[model samples]
Target: MLFRVDVAAAEPLADQIAAQVRGGILRGDLAPGERLPAARELADVLDVNLHTVLRAYAKLRDEELIELRRGRGAVIRADADAARLRLVELARQFVGEARRQGLADAEMLAIVREAQP
Candidate 1:
């Protein structure tokens, strides 16, 4: 997976890393069982602290999106894609419900916008 970091962005480095990695998984850019670069190497590549990358990896692990193994580095979880797929399925159901309720696309989008963290 490709990673890019913006030093000037308001988000923390670890969060940025996690977000990008999650996005890659959702977009099918990262396949299950793919090994991520070592934290130290990724830190050097992104010019961030080693702990920053570790934190990101930990977050992914917590979400069951990746697995961190000794002598094996970080690897995407086999069932990781299921989460995104489920989200897509739920979205389709939600859109259908919204349509049935006579909600316009723009109205549904507005509701989604308001639900963002």
Candidate 2:
């Protein structure tokens, strides 16, 4: 009943929230047809405004990652494709940020290799 997420990139908070929920669906952390918390509850859990959470949910609905049902909150879709796209985008962003931070190719590669898969 708890949801926590880190804010990252230049993406809006709503988009960040949507991306995380999309990823969770793809990774099976949030199973298909599972019930999502109410926007208010999620907002409280994430310490974001209700409007922010609703925006995320709306975005997810548009992406087909979740569907709004009467009195049932949002439900996960059977499949969500947004995850792969988000991962790729995030990787590119990370690479760009690392380069901007003056991390050399060797250093980046070392860090990647050292990271646990």
lDDT of 2 at 110: 89
- The 10 consecutive residues of candidate 2 with the worst lDDT sum are 1-10
Model 1 lDDT-worst window of ten: 81-90
Candidate 1 stretches greater than 4 Å from native: 82-117
lDDT of 1 by residue, 1-117 (tens): 789999999889998999888878877888999889999999998889999999999988998899999999999999897576558557867997999899999999998999999
RMSD of each: 8.1, 6.8
Cα distance off (Å), candidate 2, residue 40? 0.7
TM-score of each: 0.71, 0.62
lDDT for each candidate structure: 0.89, 0.79
In model 1, what is the error at residue 20, expressed in angstroms? 0.9
Q: 2-103, model 2: which lDDT tens digit per residue?
A: 355666657788978876776676567888788888888888877888999998899889867788888999998766555664776577677989999999
